[model samples]
Target: MITILNSDKNEVQKLGDLKPGDRAEIIGFEKAPVDFENFLHRLYEVGFLQGSILEVLQEAPYSRDPISIRIKEATYALRRAEANLIQVKLCE
Candidate 1:
């Protein structure tokens, strides 16, 4: 049986809402108005595009900065703006 995981409503509000210890799968990405395709391609090159698995490692206290996350075998820090483009399905 395929079971869908429940996600936090607030945390899934936007890409910037992801927090530490959250497990999620990338579902889609929001296209930026300027340089939209370029932006998407860049994210794909960095392993943040569609079908990616993400694990939040840590977030800043202010919650207005970058966040540390794990993708595949690499850990990366992304600014709030960049993260906001990546949509995800939170894993329960």
Candidate 2:
């Protein structure tokens, strides 16, 4: 996976890199997956839009395959693979 450096010098981190209680702003997606278009559509439809605020609420106890996150007032679980595709600018 590719890590991005923000123009303002703030660290850009992958959504999967965040731990519980971490908050960030969605920036963009990284290397496109096979169904990139659909992925983007689904993410946007579910409120994973750019500039949206995201908070990591929990992670699976064992494999951590699915991570629970909050966006606005809604919560959703995303697989590590899908999370990695999302790039975010960490909130201080």
Candidate 3:
């Protein structure tokens, strides 16, 4: 059984630091805007849904704003606004 762990505020880290090809399971969101529902729906459309597996591809220099990620065998570039809302646990 998969145990769902809540993301602790102290555990927050930059998504860019994740190694390429490493997989993680999304758990919760942080730094969400006031229009959280809309923002979350958009993320879901781009494959950032809860329980989805994500693979970090690359991070741009000087900014983690645009992060390249692979989900469900498809890749996408997400802005910081959306990336910040995604919380994940490193897969072993």
> Which candidate ranks first by TM-score, i.e. highest?
2
Worst 10 residues of 1 by lDDT: 5-14
Off by over 4 Å in 2: 1-9
TM-scores for the candidates: 0.74, 0.82, 0.64
The collision pairs in model 2 are none
- For every candidate structure, what is the RMSD over all alpha carbons to the true structure, in angstroms? 4.2, 6.6, 6.1
List the global CA lDDT of all models: 0.76, 0.86, 0.71
| Cα lDDT, model 3, residue 47 | 74
Write candidate 2's Cα lDDT for 20-46 as tens digits: 898899999887767777876787898
In model 1, which regions exceed 4 Å deviation? Answer: 1-13, 35-37, 61-64
lDDT accuracy of residue 77 in candidate 2? 92
Model 3 clashing-pair count: 0
Pairs that collide, model 1? none
Residue-level lDDT tens digits of model 1 in 1-92:
99665446324445567768888888887867786678667778989866778899888677547888899889888887878888887866
TM-score of 3: 0.64
Residues 21-84, candidate 3: write the lDDT tens digits.
6677887767666878786787788777778888888766777457689988888887655676
Give the better candidate number (1 or 2) by lDDT. 2
